[model samples]
Target: MTTSFQKKTRSKVLQIPGAKPSIYNNQLLISTGIPSLDHILGGGVAVGTILLIEEDTYGNYARLMLKYFCAEAVMTGHSLLLASADADPEQILKELPAPIIDDPGKGEATLEEPSHDSSSDNMKIAWRYRHLPKFQSNTSGVKFGHYYDLSKTMESELTQTVDISTVDSSLCACDSKQTDGEFNNPGYNSLLKTIQEKIMANGFSTTTQVEKRNILRLALHSIGSPMWGEKGGLTENEMYSPALPRFLVGLKAILRTAYACCVITVPAHLFCDKAYVRRLERLTDTVVEVDSFVGSDKEKNPVYKDYHGLFNIKQLPCLNSLVCNMPDSLDLAFKLRRKKLTIEKLHLPPDLSETANRSQEDPLKNLKPSSGCGTGGRSNKLEF
Candidate 1:
């Protein structure tokens, strides 16, 4: 335990009276849309920071909480960019807040490009706000920029887009033939190849490139799960080794293009060892853990079953949420907070009373022991 003397020393160090122009940088922070969480983060997320959200027993709740940020960004006119290597965007958006403006039905928004006769200033403004075609098919050598437009992305769906700057299009490792098989078995290689090609062809920037109109909240979901790979046969070592490097490189490129970056990762339990989680944590600037809680009949909850008590967002060390087991999340949170982290009760929609009541009848009926981690399920872990 830290003694009173050590606490005073630490506080003194943090509260040093400033001398003229110290070169120390600012602490990065992201808001959880909750007063308590924002307070814990020291303010809102620092500019150009990537926040990782992860959960296992309450994984769905974890994703739901992230939507709060996305909804806020959209309402504030930030262009939300969601990219998942595995899960479908539709599912992810369901847990998020609804969009402010619904553009018809098909998720498409079309705007006329200014003619060449238009002034250069007009083009500059247009480029800043427009949702450019960011996906491509590298193996087929087909460049499909501007071919598709997202007319509507529900706040709940998980978005999948290849930003084209981090991917190597020429070295296509994906095969497009098989559809009903595993992604790591060569079926989804074409998509990965396309993503890499787009990243390379689009020209990745190492320096921070700023844009005022397009504050793209980029969410690169689940990057290392072999389930998302298409070539198969990759050893655990091979997968874990490149996790951080690729993330770092991708993050650098993302910072250059978007105003904000949101990276969602699988729980740390999915990894074969602690080292994998460590590697993933190195790339993040802000980490938010999706903490699950038991339901209390005396209180109301969100409409969604998983939303029962998801408001408990915990901070992680190294700024990455690796929720494999309880220990990992707690460990990460403790490190990130640099001390004991306290959480408040998560508030949910009042309309969920019926659902909450039914769920409480048989809480663990649907839950099974988590095979990857010793923490078991949220039903058995959290006390309401």
Candidate 2:
């Protein structure tokens, strides 16, 4: 016979929050700038998350994907800081979509309000493209004229301007005067100085406070390159002077000054060197891998193309390739199947637009009907 105390002390099963995956509080996840790809990346990338992309020696313009994010941030009233370790800004701008290089007012269609209807959205897109400049600009001397104002009524109007100053490099890192001994990277220091000069030219004070109204997006490309291999540098330990650490410190400093951060990298070649990837991974909240390898499609179309559409992956060594042959939206799901590209719905966070309704109803019910999250994957191809 057990005593009363012993009965009370019976083993109780522990009831705790399931250790399943979920979104975090205070995390600002933004889109991958690619609608379909964003779903795979857990609903765009969380702000301040570090994104990695791998490019082979073939010199693919991997950075073009970044132009999408940069354009999105600017349209939404964010100031962007882009750091390019090896490429020239002008060259990078050239390969991007013409609309991205054009002013926002002239590029994007001005919709009075967003609609959930696919037909309406396509109509608006067509109208905007119709209004875009037909002939490219020939004059080298372009003026920095009045552009879109976030506070004005014309904020939705697209402009035709190409203001490099808007994407200047100098506005990164912390107070230019204060020096952390950790900022021992010489290449980073040089790049920082160039970036600083550009920022100052654009009328930014080195120590000026960046307001909450502006979401600041900063990207450090090719953060750790093997070209600057650890060998033949400073002493074994003192070689903490490449683009990676300074970028880490600079990114952290900006987080306090800005509303958000976006860091991009290419690790396939450099990161394989064990030492380089380990160092770069230390400075990130989230890491997203953007993979661009879509296998050859010789069966559907006889003509060959060097490149394929982009895909975002969890990156356990080329897992992103799973969706390379698929279309980005459900509307194209049927067409993509004809072309041989597959479609897969992925789990993601609640849409920000549905926040109010979500709060009033069961959050689980907010899932979109056509949303691919629960569906098994399918694929198709584009026939040139």
Best by TM-score: 2
Q: Give lDDT tens digits, candidate 2, residues 75-100.
A: 44445566664565444444333222
lDDT of 2: 0.41
Per-residue error (Å), model 2, residue 323: 25
Return the top candidate by lDDT: 2
**lDDT of all predictions, in order shown?**
0.40, 0.41
For every model shown, what is its TM-score relative to the native structure? 0.43, 0.45
After the best TM-score superposition of candidate 2, give how far the Cα of residue 374 lies from its true spot, in angstroms.
45
